[model samples]
Target: MTSEFAVELRDVVKRFVTPEGNEIAAVDHVTMQIKNGEFFSMLGSSGCGKTTSLRMIAGFEWTTEGEVYIEGNPMGHTPPFQRKVNTVFQSYALFQHMTVFQNIAFGLEMEGAKEDEIKQRVGRALEMVQLTGMERRKPKQLSGGQQQRVAVARALVKTPDVLLLDEPLGALDLKLRKEMQLELKALQQQLGITFIYVTHDQEEALTMSDRIAVMSNGRVQQIGTPVEIYERPSNKFVADFIGESNFLDGQIKSLSKDEAQVFIPALNTELRGIPISQGLVKGEDVVVSIRPEKIRITEKNAKNDNFFKAKVTNTVYIGADTHVYTESQGVKIKVLEQNHISRLDTSSFYTVGQEVGLVLMPENTLVLKKV
Candidate 1:
């Protein structure tokens, strides 16, 4: 572990003995480094070891194998408060009887800090979260978003080297959660402190993280920026989990440096220039994943190598875009297109059972491993 990393998990594993006397690894062989002052996230669904990993880092759960290092120092027996880290949980666990100021200053008071210093630190932390002048109110007087801010301020007043957040925004509604994503990202950058966030929501992870570590089954599938994860997934799990993708089974006919020709059985034709995954070979069975938004649905046929004509089965006109569903060769294809044209005219939008052309360009197509 290097000093540049704020936290390092070297093959950390957490195992629990099930009631059936079976041992299961909740966090298995996970190894990664969180860069200093970076907003990193562990994203996965429930029981995928995301929260267990955070607990290990926060000293709630001890590592069963490997080591956890903070700032190049091993955290073998160090306790939570002594390890220079604080955690903001999903519940926003505040004292109901205490005022906002008291909750925020409680940690400092626990450390035996002078009253004057605790007041100054708590005031600054409140200012950082933009919740100043509401010090006298109790947790019951605040909204969900305000209570979340109080939780953040309470942890931040400690000035820990790293802040561990376990789905802090999971309690908020959709709109407020989205708003806090941007706000938290901005605050992290302004403070230049490491933040380790955990979330199961894909959109929230993409919205806030500087880089994401996508985990599943207690293992990391891939780690990259939001664009890389969405654009080029490493395997089937990643492709299916990140976003909506139309997967078509195929076999590689030929492969080149940047593209591959795949033979899709449903279409009974070969698609050329489909981007291939690393180490893909010819004649190997693969899956061609193309996002619905990438396909263009129009009346005119594009006489290119990667075009298909199908009959539209359904059309749904949402506010910003329309989801057009078409079927051809026993394969249902979904196309998402922007409603840049007028929708008042029902004739303009493709009606059900109407013939439409779908263009799957090479730039937007991704050929993935079967896995």
Candidate 2:
């Protein structure tokens, strides 16, 4: 096992047999690597095999094919306890009878560390997770956040080379979940340990991971940095999954080096966009993706070349922001605006049934072949 990479999976495949004897592939021919001390994530919707992949790496499930390596050593048949990895589960599975201190110290004690050494390690791990004074409290006595911290502290106290977290914050409320996300990121940096995090929340994955692998239907869709995944999605699935986008199906009207023009017949307009693929020709079917917030809403008939007129169908006020939904050329477009800014001088406040124009910025509009 090398120390450079904390985890590696090569063409890992896992299958299970149903009650009727049918084979169901939970993980289908996947290969990935998580570097040492990096925050990595596997993100996808429900039943996408994200959690199944994580379990294979954590030694909770045996792979039907391929190999899993930890620190350059094959974990082909290694038992969960033998591998130098720890896991923090979504349930915050702390022992009921053990106090926070004992729970954190349990792993070290099982490893047969000296009394003094276990005390020092457990104390430091507790302090690192900011649960220093609550050592005497049992799991039932601690708040949800505090109990979750105990789970983290228990895993970290052992000083494993890799940590696997399967939606550790899934049980927490929104505010607490957000708080733990920041805390977990900071803690990973402080300890310099590889963290393999799994979550279905796109925003959480974007906010936390250094690099993310987006998976669907037991296969990886795309693996890239957050910006790359969100700004230049490889396919329609990823483009629609990462964030709110306006998807327009049109035919390629023209193509340049990196840009193209798409014609939407319903709108009777040609829209300019960024093309990420080659082999596209004139009249070929294409899909254009543009973020909702990247569009500028105008009250007057703007002279912009890419502007399209629409009627405001509804308005949604979300405390700090407002979402304006409009129908233009048979397509629904959404515009999000922060409520902090004062009334703008140009565009008037949108109202239901009012006519408005939506403009898509050139750089923000992405054009790709339909998936």
Candidate 3:
């Protein structure tokens, strides 16, 4: 009912009966507001209901409960074609027999637009997707990325209020996928249209979305900006899912508004000044989430309160960064240290079983509820 949001889902639910005759909620009680001209994403792994939620918005599947709204109007069981939305699927579903121009113009043709209007719209669509000169080529003649562009152009030629993308970059290889992620973000900003993107890849979501809704078991776990989601995760699942984290089981020893202390039995030490999640009480079990890049590997004791002496169990020297695996008090931890110098001798590299000290900065260490 709110005009501020381009798309809104209010407590939407989608259930399906399995082959064993058991009903399950594929999308459970989902509610979100996608702003106009915003790039919002639903991110999760397989079976997390991200694609299911997108389908509900695209009208491929009806919600079992709650409501779906679009552009200040309630969309109750409206057919996909009737709604002001278009979808780009993972398969790049372009008509193989149709040339790029025809593929882009098909939607306008179906809407009964005049020949001149259709040609003008199709030309603009191709230009928007950066396939201006590929008009005469068929889908089969295009590369994977180019074919994907055709799919996007087809959807855009409809001039829908919102575009739903269901893993549109899933079929591309790593390099092309990364390139398209940035390209799509730029395109969304240029067009200023609501984009409801669904993907299981965490990196892609973080790189593209203005805000991300992380889901699991058909329920949304957290929704926030990429920085907020990564740095101040709402729970343990979020910390572990968005990026690499070194989780240490601990219990809260003291709590305060500005600081807290957690006792880790494995390290035989308590970490203090670590930021605590909301409602975290004293004496409650928690996990300390430290990113691999946040931990500093030092040869000396650093004389810091958060420093711990450990032995390196493994060392992997990748060109950009070196992954140092160490064990402190039977707790395995990983440190991602950036390579700043060129050392030709292997002696300069950290060796296995080398004694080292690991430092956990107070700000980077997060105390999260053990979910």
Per-candidate TM vs. native? 0.96, 0.93, 0.96
lDDT of 2 by residue, 153-231 (tens): 9998888999999999998999999989999999999888899999999989999999999999888998999999998
Error of 2 at 344 (Å): 12
How does model 3 fare in lDDT?
0.91
lDDT of 1 by residue, 1-371 (tens): 24999999999999999999999999999999999999999999999899999999999889999899999999997888678899998999999999999999999998999999999999999999999999999999999999999999999999889999999999999998988999999999998989999999999999889889999999988989899999988887888899888999999999889789999998987888877668899899999999999987655566766888899899898989999889988999888988888898888788788887788888888888887
Name the 10 consecutive residues with the lowest summed lDDT in model 2.
340-349
Candidate 2 or 3, higher lDDT?
3
Give the whole-model CA lDDT for all candidates, comma-separated. 0.91, 0.87, 0.91
Query: Better model by TM-score, 1 or 2?
Result: 1
Where does model 1 exceed 4 Å of error? Answer: none
RMSD of each: 1.7, 2.3, 1.6
What residue runs in model 2 are displaced by over 4 Å at the alpha carbon? 1-4, 278-281, 343-348
